[model samples]
Target: MTMAGTLYLIPNTLGPADAGAADPLRALIPDEVQAITAGLDCFIAENAKTTRAFLKLVALQHPLAKPLQEIQINELNVNTPEAMLPQLLQPLLEGRNAGLISEAGVPAVADPGANLVRLAHAQGIQVRPLVGPSSLLLAVMASGLNGQSFAFNGYLPVDAAQRGKQIKMLEERSRKEKQTQIFIETPYRNAALLETLANTCQPGTLICIATDLSLASESIVTRTAAVWKKQLAAGKAPDLHKRPTVFLFLGQ
Candidate 1:
C-alpha cells in the first residue's frame, strides 16, 4: 500500500463517555481507530500492551474487526520512538507515512511520542492529527473555572513538601487571576492531593473533581472546599482517583 505521506497523531477516546455517547466526536473514535488500522501503512504506539488492553475493553461494546497489530510494527510491540524510532523512521525514510498512537490521548501531550513528532518535523514530513477524546481536555471543559485562561500543569512533585508547595503556588495563581489550574496525580497519591488541596486552598475555593470519566463509574463534580471535605470524609471517595484523576481548581 502506498503511504499518504501524512503522519497521523491519533488520540484514543477510551472512556465510557466517548464509548457510550451519541455525540459526533464520541462516534468518531471507533471509526478513526478502524480507519487507522486499514488506512495507515505503518503505525507507532506508546505501549502495545496498554493499547491491547484498551482495545479489549472497547471490543465489549464494539468488536474491532481489525486488531492493532495489523498496522505494521504491531508485532514489534513498541509505542515510543525511543523504543521504535529507528524502525518506524526506517519506513518513513523510505518515503512511507507513519501513524503515532499514544496509550490514551494524543501523542506528546503527556506521553512519549514527542521524539517521533520532533523527528518527523525535522525530516520535513507532513503531520496530521485526528480528532479524539482527551481526559485532560474533558476535565477542564467541565471544570467550570475560567475557561478563557487556564494552564494544563502536568503532574506535580511527588515529595510531600514539594507537592504541598506546588499546590500552594497553583492555588495562588488561580486565586490571583481566577485562572483554572489543572493537573493529575498517580492513583495512590490521589487522596494525598485531595488532602493537600483541602488544606491549601481557601475555604470557599471552587474545586472540580472529574473521576473515572467515560467508564461505568464516570463522575465529575464541581464543589466547594468545605463540601468536598465533608463528602470525602463521609466516604464519597472517587473511583477516578483509583486509576487516574484530573484535579481542577479556581479559587474564589
Candidate 2:
C-alpha cells in the first residue's frame, strides 16, 4: 500500500509584499518554513496569483523543487462545493505532498481553508502546521486584554445600526464571561468601525486596534472607549484606510 502524503499548513505574510521589513520574507518567515515551502510542488491556495508571488519570494531564499509553471496550484474559496473537496485532496491521496496556504496569515482560521483541513482529517491525511505570525494572536497578546480567555468573532455586521447592536452584544458577553472579544472589518470601513466602537461601547471598555501586523506600518493601541472617543473628537484617530487590521475589546 502506498503511504498517504502529509499536508503542510503554510502561512503567508499579513499584507503586501513590501509592507514589512526590508526582507519581509526573511524577517517574517523562519528559515525552516521557507525551506519547507520551497520544497512543495503541489498546493491548495486561496488565489493562484498570490501563491505564485509568495513562491517567488520563497525561491529567492531557497530554490523551488520544481519550476513555478510546473507547480500545481488549486483554488479554494467559500463558494467551493462540499462535493468537490475530495477532488482537491486527490494529490495527497496519490502520495504527493501538498501545502495549504492562506491569502493572509495562517490557513484555516477565518479562511475557507478550514473546510479542506477538516476533510483532510476525516480522510486520515497527516496535517502538519508550520509556525508563523497570526494577526489575531498578535493583537490579543499586545491588547493588554484578557488573553487568558478570548474569542475571535471574525467580521462584524457592516450596517451601522446592526453593527452597533452586535458590538454591544459582544461587549456584554465579554463583561459577563471576562473574555476578550476580537473581530475585524473591511479595510475601507475601518475608520467607521472605530468610530462606532468608540461611541457604542461603555466608557471604561478597552479597545485595541492592531493594524498591519508584522509590517513596518504596524500599529497596536489599547485604550478605553472614553479615551478613544476623545481622540476621535480631536480628529486624532489613526489612519486605517485600506489597511488590514484586527480589533479586540474587553469590557470591564
Candidate 3:
C-alpha cells in the first residue's frame, strides 16, 4: 500500500460522506497512511497532536512504520508562507506526499490549508478534497435563507455594545435589501445573544436558529422576534443553547 512518498490532501468532508469508509482513497486513515508512508518523513496538518487524536478514534493503530506519533504536520510553525516561493515547500519536499488535513470541514475552502494547496499546486503535488460535512453550507441549506445571495459573515463582534449595534443594523439591512445575514456565537452565550437579538431587533423580523446540525439533537426553527419571545418566555427555549448554533437574520 506504500506509494514511496506523495503529498495527499484529504478533506474530512467535502460533500457529506465519510471518506475513510467508502471512498476509493481509503488510505487516508492513519494505519493506511502508515502503510503507505513507510519511507515518508512528515505530515502537514493544522494540529499534529489533535489530528492524531482523531485518527486514534478510528482505532487505527499504525504499525510497521517508524511511528505515527513521530511524523510531523508542519502547520503549527508558520502563520503563512510570505512569498509562495519554493523554500516553503520544506514539508512536502522531505517526502513524496504530505497528507493535508484541516481541523474540520473541507481543506482550503474556509480554512488555513489554502496556502498548502497553492504550494502543492505550484509544485504539481496532487491536491484532492475528500468528502465530509460543512456547517456553513449545511446552515445555508436548512436556513431558508437565499443561499445564492447570502454571505457567511463568520462570528460577529463579541463586544456587547458593538454586537448589538451590528445585529440591529443587519436586521434593518436584511429587511430593506432582502439580504440574509447569517452569523454565529459560542454555544454557552446563545441565550444571552438570543435575548439581545429579541429585544434589539424590530418586531416581526424573521430570525432562524439552526443548532446541533446533522447530529442526534438538531433544531432548525424560523420565527419572528415577537413569536420567538413568546416561545422562549413559555419555557420553549429549545435545546439550541446547549450546543452549537447558526442564527440567520432574514428580513421580512
Q: Which candidate number would show the highest lDDT if scored against the true structure?
A: 2
Choose the strongest candidate by TM-score.
Answer: 2
Q: Candidate 2, after superposition: displacement of residue 170 in Å?
A: 0.8
CA lDDT of every candidate:
0.70, 0.92, 0.63
Ranking by lDDT: 2, 1, 3
Question: TM-score for each prediction?
Answer: 0.80, 0.96, 0.70
lDDT of 1 by residue, 170-236 (tens): 8888889888999888778888788778776787888888887665576788988888787778888
lDDT of 2 at 141: 91
Tens digits of lDDT, candidate 2, 1-252: 777899999999897776333455877889999999999999999888999989988887799999999999999988788888999999999999999999999999989999899999998999999998899999999989998999999999877788989999999999999999999988999999999999999999999999999988999999999999999999999999999999999999
Clashing pairs in 1: 15-214, 16-214, 16-215, 17-214, 45-79, 46-79
- RMSD (Cα, Å) of candidate 3? 6.0
| Stretches of model 1 off by over 4 angstroms after superposition | 1-4, 15-33, 52-70, 74-87
Count of clashes in candidate 1: 6
Clashes of 2: 0
TM match of model 2 to true structure:
0.96
lDDT of 2 at 121: 96
